[model samples]
Target: MSTPDRTANAPPLDQPAFARLPRDTGGPVFAEPWQAQAFAMAVRLSAAGWFTWQEWAQALGEQLRLAAARGEPDDGSHYYEHWLAALEQLVLAKGLSNREMLRERKEQWAEAYRLTPHGQPVELSAAMHGDHAHARVLGN
Candidate 1:
């Protein structure tokens, strides 16, 4: 499918809510490092042609609506959770990543995080790769 215009689905920059997103010298602001990473990942995946901006918006909107239906407080604290759900859904739908692979990777990350010292950044190590199947995947 042809890529949609980049500017079409973007929230207006002048809007107060849009402005409230934490910002640096450029781009949208995020409350935390992971939030920024999630935002960047979505932008990168979209630019890589995995999905269109409109599709991403729809997925995110749907996720938010579902959360609201489930009685999630819609006070914007869970915005990134919806973003992550949308990204995961789009990724799985597009066949870019499977649930099993994502689950395995998540386990690896969790293991790595658990083993790391509090002040140090977590890094996946060979010791964390319990089996041969993940050896190559973890190596990268």
Candidate 2:
């Protein structure tokens, strides 16, 4: 399938930070820190040889196409949700991680986020594991 053209709304070259985004995407990309984090993680993983840029593009394109088919709003605000979904799919397909591992890690982060007081950063601690066994994973 042809990728949707998103260059019409991208931030211009004069805006250094946003210049890398496709020119058709809406201005003011990344609504939250986690969105940027997820984007960066995908890039980092790809750089680390987990997947190819073409594969990543195909996965994200498929996600966008599916969302569009579902009658979801394509206002671009939820683009990162599709990005994260694609990342999860790629990781699973590559056998880099499984659904259960992802779920458990998500639960750990959720618990950390929940226990964290508002306005404070969520951190995974040794205590969260009830032992230091998972401390190495946290270090990663």
Candidate 3:
């Protein structure tokens, strides 16, 4: 007997990759099914190699479990947060990224925030750094 091809067994990315939850029940701003769908689409696209999907999923799942354990009611966390948590988890699991990368990006945003004369923040993106840079600075 030979081992089967795992790649061939993999489900198509177009199919549902996650379970659905009641839209109206989980947190504000995510009270719509479309919002959840948007998050899912981002994850799926990242996983398909548009970026690092594994990293994103890892982060998102970790955040969700942490929130749940911290007494955050299931109804309280926004659906996007859960998606983000999973992303974080996947990142960490795959070593595609790390907390230091996140921390550094955050520090950059903070520095940008303080230096902006407009008392506003800056916006950071992968294009700005020429890499898959995470974190965003708003306002500026």
Give me the candidate number with maximum TM-score: 1
- Candidate 2, residues 1-140, lDDT tens digits: the string is 88889889764343233324444545556779889999999999999999999999999989987887786756666899999999999999999899998876776676677667889877876226666534544554
Please list all clashing residue pairs in model 2, or write none if there are none.
Answer: 6-24, 6-25, 7-23, 7-24, 8-24, 9-24, 9-25, 10-23
- Candidates sorted on lDDT, descending: 1, 2, 3
Candidate 3, residues 1-140: lDDT per residue as tens digits? 79877886764454233546545534465557756675776667585775575556556656766776675655534657677556555555557779888777666666555555674445553214444333333323
Residue-pair clash count for candidate 1: 1
> TM-score of predicted model 2?
0.67
Q: After best superposition, candidate 1 residue 76: deviation in angstroms?
A: 1.0
Candidate 3 Cα errors over 4 Å, as ranges: 1-66, 119-140
Q: Report the error of model 3 at residue 91, Å.
A: 1.5
Instruction: State the weakest 10-residue window (summed lDDT) of model 3.
Output: 131-140
Q: Give residue 116's error in model 3 in angstroms.
A: 1.6
TM-score of each: 0.69, 0.67, 0.45
**Tens digits of per-residue lDDT for model 1, 1-105:** 898778877753432342355434654567789888889999999999989999999999899878866866566777898999999999999999999989997
Off by over 4 Å in 1: 1-28, 126-140
